[model samples]
Target: MSRQVTPRAAPFRQFIVKVHGRCNLACRYCYLYEGPDHTWRTRPAAAGPKVLDQTATRIAEHAARHTLTDLSLVLHGGEPLLAGAARLAAFAERVRERVPRGCVVHTTVQTNATLLDDRRLAMLARHGVTVGVSLDGGRAAHNTLRVDHAGRPSWPAAVRGARLLAERYPDAYAGILTVVDPASDPVETYESLLTLRPPALDLLLPHGNWTAPPPGLPGRGTSYGDWLCTVFDRWWSAGRRETRIRLFEECLALLLGLPAATESLGTEPFTAVVVETDGSIEQVDSLKSAYEGAARTGLDIFRHSFDQALNHPGVAARQTGIAALSAQCQACPLVAVCGGGHYAHRYRAGHGFTNPSVYCTDLQRFIRHVASRLRESAALTSGGATR
Candidate 1:
């Protein structure tokens, strides 16, 4: 008998095109701006016509070659709205027009909500592009770090934008993306976000690695995990799904032996890649949090195919699944569910990305807690069936 082996490379399905290189607000903890990488400083402010055209062509070529049925076009940036809503819609149209006819393109813009106005939301909705907003949390106090160039708080404007999207353009309101802040009250943070009426939620851990540990990460404690578990309990005991909390739902799916993957977990191959503002093909942008030039692949749309990028060392490493993990990770009981953590979280100054995640203890704690809840649920169902 022969064992099945995972492929060396998987075709890219999510194309993150950086439309703008500079942000309207100067977020204090933004990994792209404040992290070790300063590559954005040298790039064009907004992706030029040449860059966008060539990128669309390259994406079409990749999709045709792979005969892909679905692909995601993520119009990203330091703040994509700085490029103007019309320009973003036009760029999305270009990709949609260029892709193979059979390929369904799902276009989205990940923006900080301060720039979202009625006109922008209407234009995005008409163009079939959804909007995903980013925030630290729901309140002004939670977003003290998210301020404008002049140091004015963006919370008031953000609130207006979020409400407008939810009220007038609900279909285009994809979700709210908030980074986990262990310092805040987890349940309070979770409930406040619900008031915005987002269809879903994207909860991301702060991007950090061993050398540059995330803020508030205790030396030997699972504070981040504890925060997540509190939120999980709140969400679970609600007796009805309030909205899609991506991290929690994905973890449950993985625990149930269902096929699921996210940037944070599971053994599924990473199939997303980034196209920088200047047309440079790179690994996931989060790698910028690890080191200077950490995301670079030396490939560009004008000269290289997405297939060519599949051969890059960083991209290949992510697709290798469990084989890419450190020996300790391979030996761990929860390897399948945690997937050795996010690739960027495994970085150390000299050792590269072979180590387990910086949040190893936190992930272990969260996974076990979820597993216990699952068992309790199963027991309840069994008892009811017996009765």
Candidate 2:
């Protein structure tokens, strides 16, 4: 099959660096460790200085080539904190030094929050590194799936870490990221996150594909959509917009004919790339959920430029908009808004990635719910204007 080429000129604006390839916790559903990908077994536990230097140089070259004024450098991991504070600080500094003087570099670290300490927090703060924590909800039960190696519950430590960040480093506390649990009460989950007073939050659907479909998805049901809609209604009715919910806001924005800023939805060219601990330049790490080595690009910062990775077949497929979607998706009215629901969630063994999301029904129901709410809001506004 001929590969589809994206019409728009896409450039690399985000780089997710896997500073550590080993995790302290053993989350039951982690797409990297617990999923199909076993490539992490061969990687160094932490990225060495040489890998960091080459990655920094490549990022600088990519920025200069694209004339990108702003770039987002995300410190990712099996657990980034496991790489130690000194390594992370040095890596961030090295990248910052290599970037062009005029380019703005926004650095962020996404952690499970178990290892956060006053000293580590201080170090990250000094470097202007924003921290994003992963917490399922406010209660222990909500986070039972996220446990340590011995299967001990990690909620207490995780919550403690989050509280410390919020109280001590409010400015540096970016927000929280929660993987959606359809079985959990959406309102309870949302309220629990409110306790941390996060500036923003993301509700991620469990990573799954057509072959190994996500849990709680029945053949004819839309439990995920129902769960999210309940949360949406509660958040919408609150009207204060107390905290920014990324998934809801992105969907609403797309519904309003605005450009989507997230890869979860819309046809926005995916500009994010991953640098594994072994210096492998790969597609988004999430692709590992699809199959073993699904993310590998046979490219590395040490030998290949970011521009070369951009032309990669996997990268090009994601940026190609409607051309990359399955036939059913192309004919659907919601195609522009849904954007086929994250590239990794459309995979199957025989068919490749040219398929609708495994969450198609849920997405359809959720989008329609949001659209209904939008129409109601518009009606109210029009009524007030005429009155």
Candidate 3:
């Protein structure tokens, strides 16, 4: 058994509320719906007013106790907009009204961009909610796997929604999120997304672990790392003024010995928590891709406080920093930078999460690549030349 590390007392600052439990589109690679966990099916399809009210109260209590100045409320779901714009807006307002004075809530809704129309965007904006859209890539061909339940392509509607946000509601446009597809041309993929004029980009790795490997991952291959490096070079070479890529930027920050935290990098405490539509409090949703019940905390807003959820073994494990890593991981030079490569990606069958990430080699390769670029840039600067 892995050693138990003392949990951090860090308060949760990011709350992902599952407003609706169902999605209109059935993307081929959706881990939450198709993964081992079936908890969503048992929960309410949408959060009833009662659940929302109690959840908001609980959130406020936690924030007040911790004296948090700023928090993030991400209205998430299989697709959050399915809960209706007015309902979502009202819920955001309620939460804002409930939070303690001076506690600023940064509200955002992560959607597939298929349901974002003029009316919906207007309502969300009025409620002070920003929009984050998920896309495989900007090109239609890049989004071939993102289809609706009827097996019809979602790119057309999705593109329209994205364009609408950029054109009419730029203030509400948070960014575009893309899951890296190693098969696609990395530079081309990055450039295509730039056409959407997103203020930022969130490039993510597909969720996977040793038990069930991610798509396109071979026995010993760094295809994913190679893909990331290709994009990193393009972004870095361009002076990185195109837009922010969260993953790459976080990597750079960690390498520079600065304080940074992301699911994919850094030793910062994981301060994000989730609230199911049925009022259950759980760990981050990414654990669903690891195994069944991987994210369950056996706690709910009705009977438990967010502080109690913080002590759950799963939640604590993530916040323990380098102590939660495996023997091999702890001995590694890149341990601090990678932070064991996301808590979920470290799971192995019988050993639980006490293992190095399945993406260990890939992380090493990518981290070194970024470090080398940083060194090159420093050298150029010292030599009185622009990189």
Model 2: weakest 10-residue lDDT segment is 1-10
lDDT of 2 by residue, 162-254 (tens): 999999999999999998888898999999889999999999998999888899653799999999999999999989378999999999999
TM-score for each of the candidates:
0.97, 0.97, 0.97
User: What's the lDDT for residue 59 in model 1?
Assistant: 90
- Poorest 10 consecutive residues of model 3 by lDDT? 1-10
Query: Measured by C-alpha RMSD in angstroms, how accurate is candidate 3?
Result: 3.0
Regions of candidate 3 where Cα sits further than 4 Å from its true position: 1-7, 385-387
| Candidate 3 positional error at 202, Å | 0.8
Give per-residue lDDT, candidate 2, residue 108. Answer: 94
Cα RMSD of predicted structure 1: 3.2
Predict model 3's lDDT versus the native.
Answer: 0.91
Candidates' RMSD to native: 3.2, 2.5, 3.0
Clashes, model 1: 0
> Which pairs of residues collide in model 1?
none
- The predicted structure with the larger lDDT, 1 or 2, is 1
